[model samples]
Target chain A: MAQIRCTDLTLAYDGVTVADGIDFTVNAGDYLCIVGENGSGKSTLVRALLGLKAPTSGSITFGDGLTAKEIGYLPQQTEIQRDFPASVREVVLSGCIGRFGHSLFYTKLQKDLAAYHMERMGIADLAKKCYRELSGGQQQRVRLARALCATGKLLLLDEPTAGLDPIVSRELYSLIEHLHKTEKITVVMVSHDLEAVMHDASHILHLKKKQLFFGTREEYLDSEIGKTFLGGAGNA
Target chain B: MLEMVFEMFTYPFMLRALGVGVLVSLCAALLGVSLVLKRYSMIGDGLSHVGFGALAIAAVANLSPLKVAIPIVVIAAFFLLRLSENSRLKGDSAIAVISTSALALGVLVISVGGGVNTDLNSYMFGSIYAMSGEDVTLSLILSAVVLFLFLLFYTRIFAVTFDESFARASGVRVGLYNMLIAALTAVTIVLGMRMMGAMLISALIIFPALTSMRVFKTFRGVVISSAAVAVICFVVGITLSYLLDAPGGASVVLTNLAAMLLFSLIGMVRKS
Candidate 1:
C-alpha cells in the first residue's frame, strides 16, 4: 500500500494557481527527492502533504492508521529560530507532544524516547545545553532528533542542507542515508543540490513551472531532458 | 511600611484594587511572553482600545462596561484574526487600523456625551484608588479562566508559538490556536484595563516578558519569572505612590520600565 498518494492535486493562493493537476505516490520505505528552482511550489507541495494547506482540487489519502504523528518533518531553519531561547532537551521534548498531547504531565517513557532519539542523533551530551549556543550543524542534528521523536515511519525534510558548509551538508546527507537504510523509513526530501540528491535518491521528482517529471533515478538519467539538465551525467 | 499596610487594609477600595491589580498583572504576564515572542506585543494595546470603545458605548447605553467590553473586544479580536489571515493586510497593519479606529471612536463618543464626567481618565491611565469590589471579582474570574485554559493547552501553545508551521505539520490546528490566543488577548486586555488602563497596558504586558527573557532558558520559566516581577513591581509601585503622592498607574508602569532596563544592563555587562 502507498504511504502517501495524491491524485490530481491542485494548489493555489488567492486564485493564482501555484501548482495544478499534480499526481504522486510514495510506497513504504521509498526514498524520493523533489528538486526544483525557486517558486516552483516545492514548499507548497510539502505543506499540502502535511495538511497545512488544502489542495484546491485533489485527494490526499494516507495509508490506514498513518496519521500526522507518524510523519517526521524537518522544515527549513530560520535565523530567528537559531537565537530562540530553548535547551536541546526542551526542543526535542516538544516532538513527543504529538503522542502525549495535553496529558498534564509527561511520563517517564516519553522522556526516555526523547533521550533515545537525541542519543541516536549524537546530541545526548548537549541535551542540557542552550539551543542558541550550539553550532549550526549541532542545531540541525537536534532538529532531526526532534523530528525523529515525533515520528519514526516517514521523514520529510525541506531544504535541510541549504545554508550549511559543504562538509556539514555531506554529513547530513550521510546521516539521512543511514536512517533510511537502518530504520527502513520512507524519506521524501526537497533540495536544490542535484549532485548529492542524484547519488542517494532512488527516485526523483523534478519540478518546473507547472511541470513535473517523476521516475526512477535510472529512468530520469536516461531521458533526454535529464541529459540536458544534468550535463550528460544521465548516462552514469 | 507597617502603618501604610494597616491603612491599605483599612480601606476596602484599596484592598479590592490591589487584588484586582495583582490578578490582572499575573494573567497579562503569562500571555505576554507568547505575544512578545511572536512580535505581536502591540496586540494588547490594540485590543484594549477596542475595550475602551465598548466601555464608552456601554456608558452611553447605561449598561455595564464589563458585559459590553467582553463581547465587543472578542468580536473585534476575531475580526483582527481574520484580517491578519488575509495576506494583503499584514498583522501589524491590521492591528494599526483596528486600534486607531477604535480609539478614535471611543474619544468621539466621550466628546459627544455632553462633556459629562465620563471618568475617562481612569480608563485611559488607570485609577486603582477608585476600584470597586465588582471590579476585583471580574478580574479574578477572568484570570482564573485564562489560567485554566493555559494549563490545558500548554504544550500545543508552546508548539504554535515557537514554530507555527511545525505545529500545523504535527496535526495541531494552527488557525484554531491562533484564534484562541487572540481571544485570550482580548479578554486579558479588558481585565487589565481597570488597573493598567488602555494606553499603558501594552507596557505592562511586554516589559516583564522582555526582562525575564534575558535570563530564563525555558518558556515556563519566562512565564513564572515575568509574573513574579509584575507582582513585585505592582506592589512596590503602589507603595511608592502612597508615600510619594504620585499617580499610581504611572508609578507602576515606570517601575516596570526601570526593572526592564536594569535587567538589560545586567545582560549587556554579562555578555561583555
Candidate 2:
C-alpha cells in the first residue's frame, strides 16, 4: 500500500511558485530518494509533505496507518544548532515528545525505545556524552537514533550526509541501508548523493525546476531525462 | 554577619522583597534555559525596557504599574518573537531595535510626564524595600502561573528549543510553545525589573542558564542547575548588598557574573 501520496502538489514561497503539478506515491517499505539541483524545490516539497508548510495548492494523502505527525524526520543541521548543549541520550529521548501526547513524562517503553535506537546506531556508549562534542558522523547517528525513536513506520532524512567525510558518509549510508532493509521502515530522503543513493533506493524522485520524475529505480534509469542527467550511467 | 542579615529580614517589607525576589529568580531560571538555548535570552532585556515604558505610562495614568506593564510587555513579547523570526530582522538586531527604542521611549515618557519622579529611580535600578504588599501578591500569583506552565510544557519546550524545525516536523506545536516561553518570560521580566530593575533582569535570565550549561550536558540537568544557581545567587547577592550597602540589582548581576566566570574556569580546567 502507498504510505504517502501527493496529487498535483504545488509549493511556493512569497507568491513565487517553485514547483508545481507534482504527483508521487511512496509505497510501504520503499526507500525513495528525492534528488534535484540546488534550487530545485526538494526541501520545499519535504516541508510540505511534513506539514511544516501548507501547499500552495493540492494535497498529500497518507495510507498504511501513517499520519504526518507520526513520520520521523532528521533535518539538515546548521552550525549553531550543532553547537546546542544537550546529551546524546537526551537528544534521542526528545524524539519521544511527539508520542508523549498530553503527558508530561516519558514512559518506560519510550525510554527503552530510545535506548534501543541508540544501541542500534552504535552510539550507546556516547549516550551520556554532550551532543556538541561528537564528530559529524556521530552526530548524524545520534540524530538518526532520535528520529527512529520518533516513529518506526517512516523516516524522512534531509541531506543526512551533507558535511561528513566520504568514509563516514559511506558508513552512514550503510547504517541507513541496514535500517531500511532490516527494520522495514519506509524511507524518504532528500540527498545530493546521486551515485551513493541509487544503489540503495527502491524508487527515485528526480525533481527539476520545471520537471518532475517519479518511478521505480529501473524505470528512472530507463527514462530519457535520467539518461541525459546521468549521461546514461546513474552509477557515475 | 548572619545575625545582621537575620535582623534585616525582621522587617515586613524586607521579607516581602526577599520573597518576591526568590520567586522571580526561580521563574527567570526556568524560562531562561529555553531562551538561552533558543538564543532569545535578550528578549528579557528588550521586554524589560518595554515594561519600563509601560511603567511610566502607568504612572502618568495613575494606574497600578503591574497591571499596566504586564499586558503591554506580554504583547511586546509576542511582537518581539514575530520580529525575531522575520528574516530581515533576526536575532540581536531585532532585540536592539525594539529594546533601545523602548528605552528611549521610557525616558521620553518619564520626562513628558514631568521629569523623573521619586519612584522612577527605584523602578529603574530597583530598591530592596520597593516591593509593596500589592506587588508581592501579584508576584506570587504570576510566578505560580509561570512556574506551572513551565512544568506543564517542559518536554515540549525542550524539543522546541533544541531544534525548532525538527520538533515541528515531529508534530510538536512549535509556535505555541514559543509563545508560551515568550509570555512566561515576559511576566518574569516585568516582575524581575520591578524587583531587580531593568538593567539586571536580563542577567537573571541569561547568567543562570549559561552557568548551568557550562556544567550540565543535558537539557533537564541544565534546567535544574539553572534554578538552583539562580536562587543561590539571588540569596547571596541580597545578603552581600545588605551587608556592604551595595545596590541590590547590581549585586545579583555581579554574583551571576562571578558564578559564570567560576563555572567557565571549572569547565576549561576539566576539559584540559
Model 1 residue pairs with clashes: none
TM-score of chain A of 2: 0.95
- Model 2 captures what fraction of native contacts? 0.77
Q: Per-residue alpha-carbon lDDT of model 1 for A1-236, expressed as tens digits? A: 78998888888998899987678888887899987779988889999888878888888999945765578999898645765777888888878767766575567987999999999999999998878788888989999998998888899999999888999999999999999999998899999888898888988887775546888889988987677778844444
lDDT of residue B36 for candidate 2: 82
Task: Give the number of the best model, judged by lDDT.
Answer: 2
Candidate 1 ranges beyond 4 A from true positions: A78-80, A101-104, A232-236, B85-89
- Model 2 has a DockQ score of 0.75
Which residue pairs show backbone clashes in model 2? Answer: none
Superposition TM-score, candidate 2 onto the true structure? 0.96
Per-model TM values vs. the true structure? 0.94, 0.96
Worst 10 residues of 1 chain A by lDDT: A227-236
Best by TM-score: 2
True contacts kept of 1: 0.52
